[model samples]
Target chain A: MWYVKNALTRKNLMALTGLFLSFFLIIHLFGNLQLLLPEAEAKLQYNWYSDLLADNILIKIIAMVLYLCIILHTLDAIYLTVKSKKAKGSGYVKDRRGRASKWYSRNMMFLGSIVFLFLVIHFKDFWYQFKFGELPLDANGNKDLYTLVIKAFDQLWYVIVYIIAIIALGYHLLHGVFSAHRTLGLYHPLYSKIVKYLGMAYTIIMTIGYIIIPIFIYLNR
Target chain B: MKIHLKIWRQKDSQSKGEFKDYTLDDVHQELSFLEMLDTLNLKLVKKGEYPVEFDHDCREGICGQCGMMINGIAHGPLKNTTTCQLHMRSFKDGDTIYIEPFKAAAFPVVRDLKVNRSSLDHIITSGGYVSVDTGQAPEANSIPIAHEEAEAAFDAAACIGCGACVASCKNASAALFTSAKITQLELLPQGQTETSKRVISMVKQMEEEGFGHCTNTEACQVECPEDISVLNIARMNYEYNKAKILNK
Candidate 1:
């Protein structure tokens, strides 16, 4: 049965879901970067962009598909965590923590779960509010989602939580991106160094870029 | 240098085990770890106690029999080296070494440091063989496999089923050990006929034998003694996925 695969085989599921969601993260991060423009420019630009995405029949369907990817990614990660623990058994396996693995690599599930919780909070605050909550009118009398983002991020706790979430997200992405490359046959020995360095740089840039928006909003307020 | 040894002593599969310690004197720091154990056993026999029961053959380190946890780490702390090849110079003077057997569900301790590696043998026996019948040895360059494939296959074939992979694993998974044999056979032209069936049977047998799944920890690779890449594991997954998809 298909359920047997979902239930019994956790590792392949992890790799498949991990790789897919990694691609999803890249696209989502790229879209969110539109918010980085100056206030007047980004508000008009990003809000129109957001409205176009929400209004498009094709994009709405794709957004639903992206939601499915995130759900499957979470489920697969949970399944793999349970199975690996069962396999290793409930015994002291001498914190093989230091030498052979990165801290983020070993703690990926925990980091991922933090990111997952952040996503829920994020979707509630911004994604759902932008889509469904009543918004104050902009200068053009359009629903003002960009202003909403800037206003909400003005809270110190919101900015702190957002930064922590992005840091966790970055750590998760850092290990997953390189590890998935290795898993799915990225084996050119010379280019391997280039790929790893690129992965690290990608993680750092994405985290900092994402972090700066909330900080800028808070400080500007 | 003088050293104290606490070695696992179990008479047979039926007997319970305990840590039995004995001090060794006038030991050379240049001796290999196994050679030091050999010296301790020699002293025990002279004093009319049972020689410490451990496994070693081909003390040059090719055979996988010489492995025992030198302290807590499998095959000791050295990377990509077997117990027999690990020299005493790695240890400081007057070190108290606690040696124990490789522990796992499938690999039951038969006596001291030797377990029933027949589980690995069973896994290999399940599908580790090629179906080639009796024939003249093929001449060199007859098959003309790509040079990279041949070298990769050679690397996979280099696995000695030493169980360092299992011992080093958090889950004691045998994916590395099993995949090496699977990859070695799958790479050759002679193994092409049964390649589909071989991977399926070997993987099923591996799972059935109560071995756990690989997490790709690379701990096994670090402790492998042969430095078997985790790449072989990815190759195994790729092959298994292909076989299942094509045949299903």
Candidate 2:
């Protein structure tokens, strides 16, 4: 209860949930990478992997946790944003405060809203279809989620949206990853510097990795 | 040299405020920013008009009493310099300068270019000091503090409580100011007696003062006159979190 009311405690929750979500992105990317294989093999392998995750008890629990993290992260952000708006007394007549920080660092909520919108479309298309909608079976008797993925990305506009969303995600992580560490109290200068660079590297890799999947699929199709 | 000014003018806290333009002729390039304002005030008073009100003391950067948004940047465009220390040479003769008070919900405007910063003092009063027995002065080496630790503490202690961090922050957060005070005491042996209590109360008091949460934009350190590090914020988080876990 005290944690709920405290600012730092709320930030701690934000950091923990954010880091967990960041970790989940790595696993999600690797699993989805199977879509890059030769078409026939790709369909079977990707579908099989999807089926494997669906049937596993641990993956189901993790999925629930992932949903919870998303909700908490979003709600906390909304609360913090409202509090900040109230704290800012009035608008400046001739403001130029932007020079002090990066554009993306200051516009995190805007970037996050983009990513959040993409998540809705993403879940409705892939996640909902795989879980609740009817899908034809593949050669391996697995639900044909891979074909769904390929068909989705094959559309030029869909691929463009995917790339745009992934880019937004990259910018979000650029600030979020290291910011989470600082919120959790990683105070040493050497280690903090290391984390800062490591965050940049991770953000770059994740962005490239996610962006290439949609582009590669759209082009190769 | 001639200078153009668009300064905020308000009769008092209850009244609405707005920018009023004025021009000063024969302005010296070497005048401090405050002195330039003084000249404007002199002109206004000679005509039996109310001089524009602002805050300043010591005329040096050390007191931290003088601060304003010079062209929207707290403490002016110069890095690591205060309002009083900033000379008019930084600006061009024909340029227009906009001077505004430090604006925040916690810092209510008392008049033109002056806001009540007592909210900062409230945070300090909550737990910014140590409780020691009244007695003869202790020996210098009695505590045996490490040289590096003393220096680090001194770095945090260099904060003059100017409220530039609050003015510069997009969220109007006082994390840098509050954390600097917390870190200065938390680092030394003398401050050990109430480490857990000190962090919790100061942080609580900070939130109670209606300041926003720090999003770690690092602007506070950028605008801070002392170049106070954002790492102090991390340290404050470290202390606050540690106390929460241990105390509970």
Candidate 3:
């Protein structure tokens, strides 16, 4: 309640939700990495893993939380963007952006929108198909999510979309990960440095892992 | 050395502003940035033209009065240098320098390069002081403070309320400025008495002033004349979040 009304509190909300999503990226990347195993083995392993996640009560709870994090993060971004625009007043007659910070840092809202569009397409294609759309069962009787993924990746345009989305995700994470820590008040210089490096590592690894999955699948197919 | 300047000229807050170009061939590299502006103003005055108006006080960097965006930087190209402290020597002959006011919704242009920064004062009034009985001065060593803590508090106390942090921030956020006061007081035993109330009121006043949220891009710290740490912002958030959850 306090968060929705106050700008500072709302920012705290954005940071909290944004960090949660960042954490989710690591977990999601780990699970999806299973897609890189030997073809037949990967198909069985990924499907079993996917089904295990789908059937687990804990995963369901986490899924709900993830959905909430996404919604809150988007809404908070919109609120902060509107506030920032109004507070900016008239445009500067001479603009020199990125003199200090990165370009992505200033255009977080724009990057977030691209990532949001990707999420919508991503969820509709995989999550929706697995849950509601007709999906064949694998040898282990799990939803044939692996086949669906390969089919999606087989298309050059779909693979390109995933690559573009992942690139945007990389830029978003570049600023978001460390910014979230600062938002949560990580002030100590040494610890802040450690967190900064850790954040960069996470962003690099997650983006690479996600990018590799689709490309590997598309190529092998 | 001759210097070309593109300066923003605004008549008033309600009027539209424009950048007017002026070439000064008599500029000396030894003159400070503000002094160079003074020379240009004198020329305009001699010609019966309206002189450019700006704010300045101590000329020394400590006063925190004179600051304007020089080429889109909060206090010009030199890092951690205030406008009054910047010498024309930092520039080269025939370089086109752009001078403008620190732009923010809260910092409306008063005239030429001067902007109203009273919003910062209102935030301080909300909760920037310690209130105790004024009967007598406390004993010098009454409350012992750690040496590191004292030093840290002093560092936070160095903020000059110059609007550079807001001007440099991408979102025009005043988190750095507001946080400096919060960190300064929150570290002291005397400050702990009203820490909860002070942070709550100050942060609320900051938002009411129409400043944007802090995205922690850290451009403010890069452009801050005092070299104020962005960590101060984290400290402020810590105090505010603590007050919101625990104070209730």
Candidate 4:
């Protein structure tokens, strides 16, 4: 069936995976907020949360699904880019971009790549370290994932990288949140307006939440 | 009014094209956009130069034949106005107008401002109609439809296939055009039998024609001469999803 082969299917794949990852961000952000508690409480609570997540079979399954979503989303983006370039045939000789779309909307791939690269670095530093690298135990015997994160955010370059990444994520979501609904067929005008406003608020809140953690950690240190 | 024109000129589909400049000094503000071009062409003919080529059939905007990007905006600067409907008053004295063919892989340049929009026809060919025997035309009120539903269907039916939507889209996507057709048929009682089949094939054809995927930038709707809503695209996606799940 051309269902699998059609552009619409590919777009639906993008929207589905993108929205799933957006959900994951909410969960990820809520957990990371534990990093902002008072020093003693932050250490124990963050590590305990990390240990809980790492140990649970259900969370592990969800993590696996998250990884698959990332891979599929990235690959589909590449495929769509190539196909679109082909569809464009020849690039416009005189481009007038600002008249047509939001700057972030037109540059989604570039912003997404920045976020993807940051994700790789993020996972390598935090997730890989907590899972496989040597770690000290807190007094409660939980892995000292909190200290690892604090130490990582302590470095100026690390914090700057994070701020940049968070900004990229913000712009990515600016286009993505409403775009996902559009792709999935949210057509009503009034509802679309509501969704658009809600999307902006969500992107702002989520990005600021993620942004504050790194800056808060860096400044407090 | 005086105007400077940078019009794309090409020999044919295979030849390279470039913008050629001309100055029109004796132009009036009352002429339609196409009429101004006609004046320019007449001037070119007296000089033994080939007049610029463009597509037009019914100058009244319903035919969907006339379109070109005027100064980077499809169907010119006026919103929801076709090229024929756009008046020269939109321009001022000494205006520099840049005209180019609709840029899309599927719409290769035929010559000058005219590009082959047959890709759109191919999508329509794939499945844009209902199948019925031609014994006799059915009575208008034989199958009752709600007023709003019929109006919604008619709104979609207003698409003239001008390819301005394609021209205006950054991705060169034809989602609005294709969706308008699908919604037109899918909303009616007579179209119910082939609704599932029509969406699948037409969507497939649209993709195969090398149009890019729609990211819903909303540019197409803004630039569409008929004011065809981008909501039609959402309806199309819903119809395609419904067809995929239920048709099987």
Question: Each candidate's root-mean-square deviation in Å?
Answer: 3.5, 1.1, 1.5, 1.8
Candidate 1 lDDT, A111-162, residue by residue in tens: 9999999999989988889878988766665678888887888788888998
DockQ metric for all predictions:
0.22, 0.81, 0.76, 0.67
Superposed Cα deviation of residue B239, candidate 4 (Å):
1.2
Local distance difference test values of all predictions, in order: 0.76, 0.93, 0.91, 0.90
- Could you tell me which 10 consecutive residues in candidate 3 chain A have the lowest summed lDDT? A1-10
Provide the TM-score, chain A, model 2: 0.98
> Which scores higher on DockQ, 1 or 4?
4
Candidate 4 TM-score restricted to chain A: 0.97
Clashing pairs in 3: none
Predicted structure with the largest DockQ when compared to the true one? 2
Best by TM-score: 2
Q: Which parts of model 2 have CA positions greater than 4 angstroms off?
A: A1-3
User: How do the candidates rank by DockQ, highest first?
Assistant: 2, 3, 4, 1
Q: TM-score (chain A) of candidate 3?
A: 0.97
Candidate 1 lDDT, tens digit per residue, B1-248? 87877787878867777888778877898999888888887878998987777778898878888787767677887888899899888887788778878776777777888877788888888998977557897686777788888897899888988887887676678888887898788888877778879878887888777677665557788888899877777667767777877999
In model 4, which runs have C-alpha deviations exceeding 4 angstroms? A1-4
Best by lDDT: 2
Clashing pairs in 4: none
TM-score of model 2 (CA atoms): 0.99
